[model samples]
Target chain A: MAKVPVQFTLNGSEKAEFIESGTTLLHALRDKIGDTSPKGGCHQGTCGACSVIIDGELRLSCLTLAETCSGADIKTTAGLAEGGVLHPLQRAFLDAFATQCGFCTPGMIMAAKVLLDRTPNPSREDVVEALSGNICRCTGYEPIVQAVLTAARANSQNAA
Target chain B: MELRRDYFADVRKDGLHEIGQPRPRLDSPGHVTGKTAYFADRNFPGMLHLKMVRSPHHHARIRSIDTSEAEKHPGVVRVLTAKDVPHNVYTILILIQIGPEDETVLADGKVRWKGEAVVAVLAETERAAQEAAAKVKVDYEVLPAVFDMEEALKPGAPLVNEYHGQNYYLYDSGECRKVRFGDVEAGFAKADHILEQSYQSSPIEHAPTETTGCVVAPEGNDRFTCYTNTQAMFFTLDNTSIILQMPGNKLHFVGGTVGGGFGGKVDVIVEPIAILGAKLTGRPVSFIYSREEEMQISSPRAAEKVVIKDGVMKDGRIVARKVTGYTDAGAYSRHSPYGAQKGAGHYPGPYTVPNVWIDTYCVYTNRTPSSAMRGFGVTIGDFALEVQMDKLARLIGMDPLEFRFINAYRDGDMKAHRQPTEGAALIECMQEASRAANWPVAEKYMAMSSYRKGA
Candidate 1:
């Protein structure tokens, strides 16, 4: 089998690697690049467990080909904390007890960050729409919605 | 299965930290940070991928299996047929009744189900193993199949297991569990009005975000480690040990971060397949069910048909209640015997029927095996009884809430079967729910509006 060389910035670190032509971005980040924090859950992109920020846009890594991710800047769940301090959304998810089971939290948090970065102050419906793709079985989406609203309050206070 | 109440009395006083409070799961951080490794994430050097070649026919006599073409494929490691499997009848999910073991991990001389595994393929790549699986050919003599429970119960129907006697799994005419208390016939005779109706509950999928997946490998000499996603991890470990014919200590079970169970993940599904694949390849193997496989092969919630006969006195008190329910325990009796017992335990609406009789029939079907879901069997029973209660109340010219409260089993009251209602809060929950939902306004709107009984 012929190996294809791919280069990308993962969690702000540059790396070049060789992966199979059919390798998914999820397999490359997890198996090849030794970044196991993004998770592997339904490979079909239905369960958003493999979500990562690619070129500053939230995307399902399982659905994206390794070749497509070449020369792209990607951010994973491991980059959510700044120098050991938890992100506002992460803290809110923890404090509000919205992180039950937690399989979808990384994707949900990344999805929320995209919404929060753009909106800064999102309504309930906006928050729902932002995290709609991410499916959480335990929390029933109530606490997750509340967590986003709480994080929005904290973010606005920090901005002021 | 033996029916017994497993409720912990005075459990609240045991510890303040045990229940009611939001105790954060210890594994939350790992899962949230994507640090929790699942079965599908596990990988080893020189590991092989395993895939099964399933039978398309629901019931068939296997004439021949030609794996020569598949074995010659590039990257293919090995192809295991029924001749390789030691156990002719592989049963991980055994029926609770202790008779009629009705399943196979890999089909032997006969294939009873459509998705029954016949041949297993191990290859250098998952894609290769998958591609090679499609090449394995099996000649089968197709037989008559039965898919409906009622049809399966009828005499002269196609037998799922011909040795199990007359298409029925267990004797006693489909009614696995029955309960009788008081003079139900005499009570019905004395009643002013009698109501008979049948209600059907639909089958629902668990739809767990994480599909079933497992990775099996040799831990060391005479030992193996299997990582799987399951609801009852310890139970699955015990079942896997029995199926593999290995000692408990020789098999190690590592649980993956559970996506969701809702009671559906309690069965043995993918772990055994992975273990079988590992044994064949002598290399670490992982088998993850695709979404389609998860839906078609994996167990779903059992559907039920309930028939209720209610008797009410002129004074708005329930005189007697008779209920007969048929549970569609698809393919195999996974949890049906116990589910039948629970479904017929009590009619479980907040009413005091002086006389009662309940019987549950768990019939077999050709669909995916039915297993536990949320609320076990009580959820389906409660809906049927509650709706019938509402209809009965309307017949007696009384408000449904008032009728329910009049006969509702209180904490100290004896139930229809003369059993004390331990820790009952039926009235309180109903009142609170009514207050919370603004029931008075809703009721007034329904009464004032042109919403007749049929409309």
Candidate 2:
């Protein structure tokens, strides 16, 4: 099979690569663009470990084809921090000890970013519903939930 | 955040530092930033991908395997079978003298369970390896398989493991693990009532977020370095070396950042085959199980059946307890014998049952071989024993907590295995739990202590 040329904006940087016809966006990001943030967990849309933002919408990179992602804007956990300053969610996660093994952290932060962007002050239930698709076997969801709530409060206080 | 000083008023005297202090996990930043180097994170130039050709039947005799089509597949590098493995027979518990080396790195003559790997294909791409693996032709003759523990034990049942020479693993005494303390018949004869019940649990999967895998790079001539997520690094190194018949120094294991082991990664599953692939192809080889394969083929916690019979007095005292249990070890013994022995050791619960008898059988059946998980042996046994206690308490119209308080083991008491108990805190733990739950206990029951009354 001939490789198809794909061009896209990744982490606010225009990137181009040639990919196979059936290559997942996750493969294109990790193998071609050398972005290693999105992990291959289940690779079946259930784990959400390969979560990335496509045009302001949360999408599972394993389920999205690189060909379909051509010319689309993408955001990943790697893009969340700027100039070595951690994002609010990342700081909150650190303070609250939200991660254990850390395999699920990137996707979890990405999921929380989508939720916080849509609703600045989400309730605990709102956070839970947003991250329901993401699975973390380590922390049992307590600290992660608290971290999201803590980040939301900080964000709202900054806005005030 | 204010510290809850009152809750730890009693525990504060331990003079512990960092125990109560909030410390960020050393790996959290790397985890959050997606910079942690897991086994799958590393990529090598000219690395080959490995995929296994697995058996579709639960039990079958492999008459022949034709790898011609797979070898002819584009980009396919090498096809390995059991013949390629230098020392094929391996049982993880062989170090503990608990096995006859029942399992092969790849399927030998017959496959005893579904998803047993028969052929390994190395290719330039994972897709090519998977495609070539699917093309490998295998001729199998279906055989009778036993799926139930009790059915496997009956006379004339088809043998699942010929290594054991029977359906059950034998201890040094040539029977299942047994524990007998006092005369249960006499204890039962003196009892007012007897209660009997059976408890069962299905197998449990660890289901770590990251599946089992390995990446082996040929470092030097006749030397390989394996990057894996196995919980026990040296165990993998030693086991893989034994399987490849190579020196221990030839294989360097790089690991310890396990995503989540929970006892699942203790088995040397992927390293041997990945190392073999690397050796045969003379290229770095990476073998990772898809989520489907992990779910279907990885070792799971054993499904267990426990039957407890207790002779009790009217005052909630269990005089005699008899336990007959079976651990479905599946087709091979990995850690099942040791797990069953742990179950036998945990028999009769943490109580002062004067007369106790326990027989734990490590049974074999046609299922995915069970190895270990969190508290593999004691967890399931405690589940059954505690539930039996609760049922007994309900039958005698006694408060469950009070019943436990009355029967909780005390220091200086001897166990069914003739080991004297030390630091027995069952009574204290129950008291603390009851106090926290606000369940009122009578003055007499509340005064019962784990410390011996006379001492």
Candidate 3:
């Protein structure tokens, strides 16, 4: 099989990799570029573990083709931290004990990030709706929902 | 979340530390940053992928398996069958000297259930391994299969496991775990009402986000290092050593980081074969179950059925209780035998019944093997027992909470299993619960205490 060459901007840096024709964006990032923050809980899109931001829109990397994202800009959980400083959402998650087992944390954080970007003052129902795609077997999602709500409250207060 | 200070005020020390404060977890930073090292995160150079070829039929006799086409496929490294395994038979409870380990690592002669592994295909990539596994041809003779426990226990039913001559797991010298206390028949004859009801529960899957998986890397010194997401680390290592017929020192297990396991990852399932692939080829081997494979092949909590026949009075006093229970120990006996004994022990629902009789059977059937989950044995048992109590309370036209307080066991009361109760607090718990819910009862019922129990 011929390996197809693809180039894209990842985490504000130019990245290039030669992958197979049907390789998923998940394998392209994790196996080739060596960024493994996005987990692969399920190869299908049902589990939002491999969720990433593509041009400011949340996308499921497991279901997206690498060749189709040749010139796209992508961001993952590895990019959430800047200069050793954690994001407000990450801080809220830590303080609220939202990340248990952590298999679903990355996707959950990305989902929450998108929801906050669109709706700065989201209600509890909005937070729940944003995180409906991700599944966390532990913690029963109470801590996670509270963490998102806490982060939203902090962000809105700063804006005000 | 209000705590009653006066309830245990005498024993409570002043200026207590670390009792009711929120403690931050140390791994929160790694978890929030998505930098925690799970088993699948680590990768080695030139690692081989392992994929399984499973049985399509629930019950079938395997005539032959021809791996010629699979071996010749592109990027295929090796194809392993039951013949490749050194010592195939293993049972998870054998660490505590539980007898007769009968389950095979790979299906040898016959497949008793659907999705039982028949052949393992190793290749350069996961896709190639999956494609190559499909090329391997297997000849099977389909047989009649039984799904339910009661149907399997019937006379002349098709056998699910040949290890036990009968359908039910043998307990000491009886067909079930037996519990006998005071005479239940005599207590029932003197009762004003009899309540007999049957309750059943369906199987529950853990369904953790990360599927069960492992990666084994062979070191230069002839030792293999396994990175797994198993809940029980030492149990997995010891069982892997026994199944591979190797010394424990030759295997270095790296774990204690599980994604999510409500007792689902306790069984040693994906380690042995992945280790064997590494040992044979001198390369790291990764065997991860897909979501579909995890759902269909992995063990779930056993479905149980319990029948509770209680002898009660119009005054909400449960005099006698007899229970007959059956747990569906599907195909192989992984942990259901011990679970049945636990089910038998949790009888009559914490009430102070004078006479109690309990018997629980672990029966085999042709389905996915049932093993551990969160509160496997006792969760469903409690569900049935509490429901029965509510029915009895309704029958006697009394408040369920008041009825429970009337039958609540005291600290000095004797339990049906011949054990004296100690530190009994059912009454206190109910009283606090009523206050929390803002559901008021009569002042007379509110004055009841667990120290002294009566109507």
Q: Model 3: per-residue lDDT, tens digit, B244-347?
A: 98999999999888988898898898999999989888889999999998899899999999999999999889989999999998888898998988888787
Q: Which CAPRI quality tier does the interface of model 1 achieve? A: medium
lDDT of 1 at B318: 87
Per-residue lDDT of model 1, residues B60-120, tens digit only: 9999989999998999988877666544354444523344556666777788778877888
Q: Model 3: runs farther than 4 Å from truth? A: B12-15, B451-455
What pairs collide in candidate 1?
A: none
Q: Following a full C-alpha superposition, what root-mean-square deviation does model 2 have from the true structure?
A: 2.0
What ordering of candidates by lDDT runs from best to worst?
3, 2, 1
**RMSD of candidates 1 onward, in order:** 6.3, 2.0, 1.6
iRMS per model in Å: 2.0, 0.9, 0.8
RMSD of 1: 6.3
lDDT of 1 at B116: 74
Candidate 2's C-alpha runs over 4 A off are: B1-13
TM-score of each model, in listed order: 0.90, 0.97, 0.97
Ranking by TM-score: 3, 2, 1
Q: Could you tell me which residue pairs clash in candidate 3?
A: none
